[model samples]
Target: MSGQRWDMGKDTLSTLAKKTGGNTQDLGGLVKRLAAAAQPLEGKLQGAGHDAFIAFKGRVDSIANDLNAGLAAIAKGQSGMDAATRTGESDMAQAAKKAEGAANFDGAKFTKR
Candidate 1:
């Protein structure tokens, strides 16, 4: 059983080395190559992140513009409402004065000279 285990371990190591295309001692070289390959990807990721930030900023600006437009519309509507209310109040006051004048004329006619 021990001999079989030893043979199995050796076979496993050799198979692993063959599959990896190199010996285990070449791990450092493989890591360096992998790092070299990853550097360009890292730069690309940074550029993508920058682009995403710009897009996000553009969206924020658009939202801010929309909010400003909404506020301006609200202000205009409020001014219109205020003007209408003032006009209505003026009309009511004029009507009250006319009614008062009519009442005074009626009272004067009912009284003696």
Candidate 2:
């Protein structure tokens, strides 16, 4: 009878020890479930980031294109203005030469003398 009681005590203690010892498979399963639960949120965040990146890239491209076009317009305007100024200067120089030729050597024909 004492032997049977001793065996029962040993069995109870062994069962308790085995229960307290953590199982690797259970822990792994729990980790997998937690990861699975977070997958949707991760995917959503990725999608949002991708959308924002595309929008930002498009905006930057648009701004760059507009800036280039504006610069080209400014260059064309400056070129036109430079051509006009050159033409005006040439005309003024020709008029001055003609006036100088019309004047006499002593500057008395057209002047008061």
Candidate 3:
């Protein structure tokens, strides 16, 4: 009666949440390290070069911010799925049994499953 299914458990959700948090922290640390490592070189650049570098760093930081937000959303959804599993949400449980790959996800329409 099914072609495919997706299954997840509390342990998987918990581990994913933990890993996502760690990744967020690591990303922040990496950004900080990049800033620290670049401080020494900023002085070497002059005028346009320094301005360009600054803009690039700003863009990178912005992308990282977006990435962190997406990760957080995914982690939150995972937790919701876990809750649904625990509380016996039939729809969520049924969907879990037939979930398929999403071609596009913006993390903007996330709802408690």
Candidate 4:
């Protein structure tokens, strides 16, 4: 006997996608709150302080925009992967069922002809 065996575990890609998508949602909410909080600070400073704040704020705003876009892309990718995994799992299930019906192994041994 070769003693070869196969063990296929449950699919977890969809679970990972859900978790990653949830993280993006949480981060997106925080980004929104940050932008809102930054609004009232505009025009409240003077001189170099104001210049520095303005410059940094501009850069932060740009970065926030990019971050949101990237997070949105991540969410989209997660959704797509989740869907693909689900479909792939269904196909695997059907195939397994078909294979089981045609299986040649008995409960205790292989019945090779």
User: Which candidate ranks first by TM-score, i.e. highest?
Assistant: 4
Kindly state the number of residue pairs that clash in model 3: 0
Q: Could you give me the TM-score of model 4 versus the true structure?
A: 0.52
lDDT of 2 by residue, 88-113 (tens): 77899999999999977785547555
Show the colliding residue pairs in model 2.
Answer: none
> Whole-model lDDT, candidate 1?
0.54
**Candidate closer to the true structure by TM-score (higher is better), 2 or 4:** 4
What tens-digit string does per-residue lDDT give for candidate 1 at 1-113? 77856663324443433434333324444444554555455445657776665454446545545555554555556556556666777899999999887785655566557
Error of 1 at 34 (Å): 39
Return the top candidate by lDDT.
Answer: 3
lDDT of 3 by residue, 11-86 (tens): 6666767788668657756775677688788879999999988886777677667767777787788678766666
**Which 10 successive residues of model 2 have the least lDDT summed?**
16-25
Model 1 stretches with alpha carbons more than 4 Å out? 1-55, 104-113
Could you tell me the lDDT of residue 18 within candidate 3?
A: 72
In model 2, the runs with Cα more than 4 Å from the true position are 1-54, 107-113
TM-score-based ranking, best first? 4, 3, 2, 1
Error of 1 at 103 (Å): 1.5
Could you tell me how far off, in angstroms, the CA of residue 53 lies in candidate 3 after the best superposition? Answer: 1.5
TM-score of each: 0.44, 0.45, 0.52, 0.52
Residue 103 of model 3, lDDT score: 32
> For model 1, what is the error of residue 20's alpha carbon versus the real structure, in angstroms, after optimal superposition?
70
Worst 10 residues of 1 by lDDT: 16-25
